[model samples]
Target: MMTVDYRTLFADVHRRPGSYGLDGSYGQAVAFIMGCDAGNAWGLLVGFPEWLAMKAGGGANLVWSALVLRIAFPGPTVVTAAETLDQQHDEHAVGALFGLLDEFLADRKGSRGAAAIVSSYLDWQRLRREQNS
Candidate 1:
């Protein structure tokens, strides 16, 4: 099986610049995308809010997002979790980001992850509306 070491990879990514002129490392990009301090980045794997902040652009995006996880589940299960999150909340913008983790994070494929995230976002939107009502 192919395994990714998140901390190491994050360290490397954070050290370089993005092709689109994103300055800083993987952590920086995540922090920028999330509007929170990337810090060590391990917390992101555990928190759904951070995941809600970003979308999947491609495999490169998934590599960084999933590798940060302390754990990784199969693509389908992670997508399911995102859908379940939707039942309680809505975060459609980043719907494409559910693909993720370490044992602390979920390992989802990019496409499925995006579906799960979109579902969660839809739920989030519903919750928001309910709250406003």
Candidate 2:
């Protein structure tokens, strides 16, 4: 599996809208999709159904949610990346996202699955960004 650079993912997601099945102008579409994903993650964390959660129920939900929130509201909705080395204390959104990843890894008893999940997210983020960009 390959590693994912989240910064690149954000740039992609920020740039692409059509590739994600969104309509409207590029910015509008990307923003809409970003909000939808973020809302779904938020919903999952708050006890929404697994199906509705969109990868929110499992251990990876935390990471998924963090990325969603980051896309939806960038630049200090929580602790900006510059603020903390340890992801746990950055911001609520970031914590929720990584929290899911952590939980998933812990439940599985290792970082193997966590790495895959991260990789997949990175790939998806990159693809979306490229399509839109």
Q: What are the lDDT figures for the candidates, one per model?
A: 0.39, 0.40
Worst lDDT run of 10 residues, candidate 1, spans: 87-96
**Candidate 2 global lDDT:** 0.40
- Provide C-alpha RMSD values for all models, in order: 15.6, 16.3
Candidate 2 stretches with Cα past 4 Å from truth are 1-78, 81-101, 106-112
Q: Report the lDDT tens digits of candidate 1 across residue range 24-68.
A: 333335555453225435444433443433332112224344423
Question: Could you tell me how far off, in angstroms, the CA of residue 124 lies in candidate 1 after the best superposition?
Answer: 1.2
Give each model's clash number: 35, 7
Evaluate residue 126 in candidate 1 and report its C-alpha lDDT on the 0 to 100 scale: 69
